[model samples]
Target: MRVETIFEMTSPYRDSFRIKGFRFGNGEKTLAIAGPMRGDEIQQQYICSQIVRRLTMAEQHGRISEGKSILVIPSCNPFSMNVSRRFWAMDNTDINRMFPGYSQGETTQRIAAAIFSALEGFEYGIQLASYYVPGDFVPHVRMITTGYETLDTAKLFGMKFVSLCKPRPFDTALLNYNWQIWNTKAFSVYAGCTSRIDSTAASETVDAIMRMMQAAKILTKTVTLSPAYEPAVVDESELLHVKASHAGIFYRLKSPGSSIESGDVLAQIIDPYNGQCLSEVKSPADGIVFFAHNQPLVFENGLIFMIRGM
Candidate 1:
C-alpha cells in the first residue's frame, strides 16, 4: 500500500491541509473511492477507512488483481472535519457542489479541481455519499441517470436498493455527475446514517464495495464475508415524499426500512414551547420507508420521510 498527498494547501492560521490517497496494487487506474467532502459525514469517512484497511490487507496478500489499481481518499475536507463543521469552515461552501471546478475559483472550487484532476481518469468511481437532509437512509447504491451510468454495475454492490435519479440542474456540479460526464462510471453508496456511525450498515457497505471490486475483476480474491444479495432497482419516481406541514420538535414513529401502509402514523411534530402535539405525520402510500428524518427539529414543509412505493 502506498500513501500520497493528492492535494495540499498551506493554511495561514493552522497546519497545512492535505487530502491523502491510499493506493493499492499497480498499473491501471481501475477504481477510485472518495469520502467525506462534508465534515459531518462521519459514516462516509468511517466506511472509506474500512475500505482502505481492507484494501491494504488485500494488497499485502497479493489479492488485488495484477495490472489493476485502487485508490481510496478517506476524507476530502479534513479541516472542516477537525472542527466538526459540515461545509468549508471559513466560507461555509460545500466542496461537493464544486465539482470539475476551476482552479482560480473559491477555496472549495480549487479543492474540488485538485481532487478531480487526480481522480479523473479512473475506470470507476465510488463515493461514500450522504443525503442533503439529516436523516437515516435504507442503505443503498445511488446513481445519476447520466448516459454514462451503468445500472448493472451499480447492482454489483449487492445492497438492498439501487436508485437512479435523473440529474437536476444543481446535480451538474456534483462529483458523481462530473465523473460520469468525464466518461467514468460513477456511483454513490449511501449507508444508513450520516453524522453518526451505524456499525451494521458500515459493515454492509464495506462488504458491498468489496463485492463490487471482485465482480469487476479488480480484486483477484474475495473477502470471507457473506455472499452479496440481489438488490432492487428503483427510479426517483417510485419514491414517495412525506413533508412536514408545521415547524416543531420532530419525533419519528417509524424508522427507515420499516414496512408501512397508507395512513400509518409515521411521525409527530410537537409544539416546542407548548409541549403539545402539533401534527401527526402519516404515510400516504403503502410502501417501505426509504428514509426518515432523525433530527430533533423540523421546519414547515420539510421533507421528513421517503417511502419506496410497493
Candidate 2:
C-alpha cells in the first residue's frame, strides 16, 4: 500500500497541512473511495480512513488475494476541518457544488477540480457523506441518474434503503457530477448529520464499504450485512417537509425514525416572552419522522421537520 499526501493550499494554522490518502494493490480494477469534502464531516472521513487502514493491514499480511486497486481520500478540506466548518476557508463556498473543477476559478472550484483530477479513472467510486442538515437520517445510497447498472450496485453495499436522484444545477456536487462525467460507477452513502457524529451511522457506512469489497471479490471471507429495508427506494420528492405553525421556543414531541400518524404532536412552540403555549406542530401525514431541526427556537415560517411515507 502506497500513501500520498496532497495539499490544496498551505494553511496558516499549520504550514502545508496535507490531505492524506492511500493507494493500495497493483491491480487493474480500481476503486476510489472519498469522504467528506466538507471539513465538519469528520465522522465520514474517520470511517473512510478506518476502511483504508483495514485494507492496508490485510494486504500487508497477504490476506487480500483479489486483483483490485483501491484509493481512499479521508478528508478534502483541511481548513474547514481545523475549525469544524463545512465550507472552504478563502470563501464560505461549498466545495461539493463545484465539479470537474477549475484551476483558474474560485478557491472551491480549484480544490474541487484538483480532487476530481486526482480521483480520475476508478472503476468504482463510493462517496461517503454526512447530512449537514437536521435529523438522524437512515443509512442509504443515492444514485446520480437512473437506468445505470450502478443502481444495482446498491445491493452490494448492504444498505436497506437507496435514494434515486438526478442532480440539479445547484446540485452540481463534485462527486455526483464527477461520476456523471467520468462515467465512473458511483453512489453517495449518507449516514448521519453533518454537525454531529453518530457512531451507529459510522459503523453502518464501514460495513457498507466492506460489502462492496466483498462483492468485488477483494475479500475471501463472506461479508455479513443487515437486511435491506422493506421499501428499498425513497424518491427525493416524496420527502414530506413539516414546518412550524408559529414563532416560539419549540419542545420536540418525538425523536426521528419514530412512526407517526396524521395529527400526531410533533412539537410544541411556546412563546418565549410569556409562559404560553403558542402552537403545536403536528404530523402532516402518516409516515416516519426523517429529520428534525436542532434549533428549538422557531419562527412563523421556520421548517420544523420532515417525514417520509413508510
Candidate 3:
C-alpha cells in the first residue's frame, strides 16, 4: 500500500489542505474509488475508508491482480468535513459540481481539476455518492445514461438496484458524468444513509465493491460473500416523488425499502406550532420506498419521499 498526496493547497488561516490517495498494486490503472466531496457525507467517507483498509489487506496478501492497480481516495473536502459543513467552507460551492474543472477558475474548480488530474485515465471509477437531499436511499448503484456508461459493468457491484439516470443540466458538472465522458466506466454507489453511518449498509457496500473487483479480474482472490440478489434495473423516470404540501415538521411512517400500496400513509407533516397534522403524505403507487426524507423540518413542496413503482 502506497499513500500519496494527490492534491494539496496552502491555506492562509489553517493547515494546508490535502487530498490523500491510497494506491494498491502496481500496473494498469484499473480502478479508482473516491469518497465524499462534501462534508456531510459521513457514510460515503466511511465506506471509502473501509475499501482502503480492505484493499490494503488485499495488497499485502498478494490478492490484487498482478497487472492491475487500484486507488482509493477516502475524502476530498476535509476542510468542510472538519466543521460539518456540506459544501466548500470558503464559498459554499460544491466540489462535485466543478468536475473536469478549470485550473484557473474558483477554488472548488481548481480543487476539482487537481483531483481529476490524478483520477483520470482509469478503466473504472467508483464514487461513494450521496443524494443531494437529506434522506436515506435504498442501497443502489447509479449511472448516468451518457451512452458511455456500461450497465453490465455497473451490475458487477451486486447492488440490489441499478439505476440509470438521464443526465440533467447540472449533471454535466458532476464527477461521475465527467468520468464517463472521459471514457472511464463510472458508477455511483449509494449506501443507504449520507450524513450518518449505517454499518450494515456500509458493509454491504464494501462487499459490493469487492464483488465488482473480483468480477472484473482486478482482484485475484475470491470474495466469500455472494450478492444477495440480482439487481433490478430501473430508469430514473420510474421514481415517484412525494412532495410536502405544507411547511411543517416532518415525520416518516415508512423507511427506505418499505413496501407500500397506493394511498398508504408514508409520512405526516405536523404543524409545529399547534401540533395538528397539517398533511398526511400518502404513497401514490404500489411500490417500494426508494428514499425518505430524514430531516425534521420541511418546506412546502419539499420532496418527502421517493417511491419505486412495482
Candidate 4:
C-alpha cells in the first residue's frame, strides 16, 4: 500500500488543499475510485473510506492480484468539506462540473485537471457519487449513456439496479462522461443518502465494489457474499415523479427501496402552524421507490418521490 498527493494547492489563510490517493498492489493501472467532490457528501466520503480500508487489508494479505494496481481517493475537495459548504468556498462553483478541465481556467478547473490527469489510463473508474437533489436513493450503479458504455460491465458491481442516464448538455463536463470518452469504463455509485451515513447502504456499496474488483481480476479475494441480486436495468427517464401539492412540513411514509402499489399513502403535508393535515400524497402506480425526498419541508410541486414502475 502507498499513499501519494495527486493534487495540491497552497493557501495563506488555511491548510494546503491536497488530494491524496491510496494505491494498492503494483502493476498495470487497473482501477481508480474517487469519493466526494462536494463538501456535504459525508455519506459518499464514508463509502470511499471503507473501500480504502478494505483495500489496505487486501494488499496486506496478498489478496490484491499481481500485475494490478488500484487507486482510491477518499475526497477531492476537503477545503469545502472543512467548512461544510456544498461547493467551492471561494467561488461557489462545483468541482464536478469542471472535468477533463483546463489547467489555466480557474481554481476548480485546475483541481479537476490535476485530479483527472491522475485518474487517466485506468481500465475502470468508480466514483462514490451523490444526487444533486437532497434525497435518498436506493443504492445502485449509474452510467452515462455514452456510445462507449456497456451495461454488462456495470452490472458486475452487483448492486440492485443499474441506471442508464441520458446525459444533458452539462453532462459533457462530468468526470464519468469524460472518463468514458477517454476509453475508461466509468461508473457512478450511489449510497442511500448524503450528508449522513447509512450503515446498511454503505456496507452494501463496499461489498459491491469489492465484488467488482474480484470479478475484474484485480483482487484475488473479496468480502462479498454470493450474488444477492440481479441488477434491474432502468433508464433515468422511466422514473415516475410524485410531487407535493401543498407547501408545508412533510411527513413521509415510504422510503427508498420500498415496493408500493397504486394509491398507497406515501406522505402527508401538514400545516405547520395549525398542526392540521393539508394534503395526502399517494402513489399513482405499482413500483419501487427509487428516490424519496429527505427533507422535512416541501414546496408546492416539489418532487417527493421517484418511482421505478414495475
TM-score of each candidate structure, all chains considered together = 0.96, 0.88, 0.97, 0.98
After superposition of all CA atoms, the RMSD between model 2 and the true structure is: 2.5
Off by over 4 Å in 3: none
The TM-score of predicted model 3 comes to 0.97
Candidate 4 structure lDDT: 0.92
Q: RMSD in angstroms, candidate 4?
A: 1.1
Tens-digit lDDT string for candidate 4 (1-310): 7899999899879989999999988999999998899999999898998888888888888998889899999999999999999999999999999999889989999999999999999999999888888999999999999998979889888899999998999999999999999999999999899899999899898889888888888989555454657899989899999999999999999999999999999999999999999999999999999999989999999999999999
In order, candidate lDDTs are 0.92, 0.74, 0.92, 0.92
Question: Which 10 residues in a row give candidate 1 its minimum summed lDDT?
Answer: 220-229
Comparison by lDDT, 1 against 2, better one: 1
Error of 1 at 85 (Å): 1.1
Each prediction's RMSD over C-alphas, in Å, is 1.3, 2.5, 1.2, 1.1
Candidate order, TM-score descending: 4, 3, 1, 2
10 residues in a row with least lDDT, candidate 2: 222-231
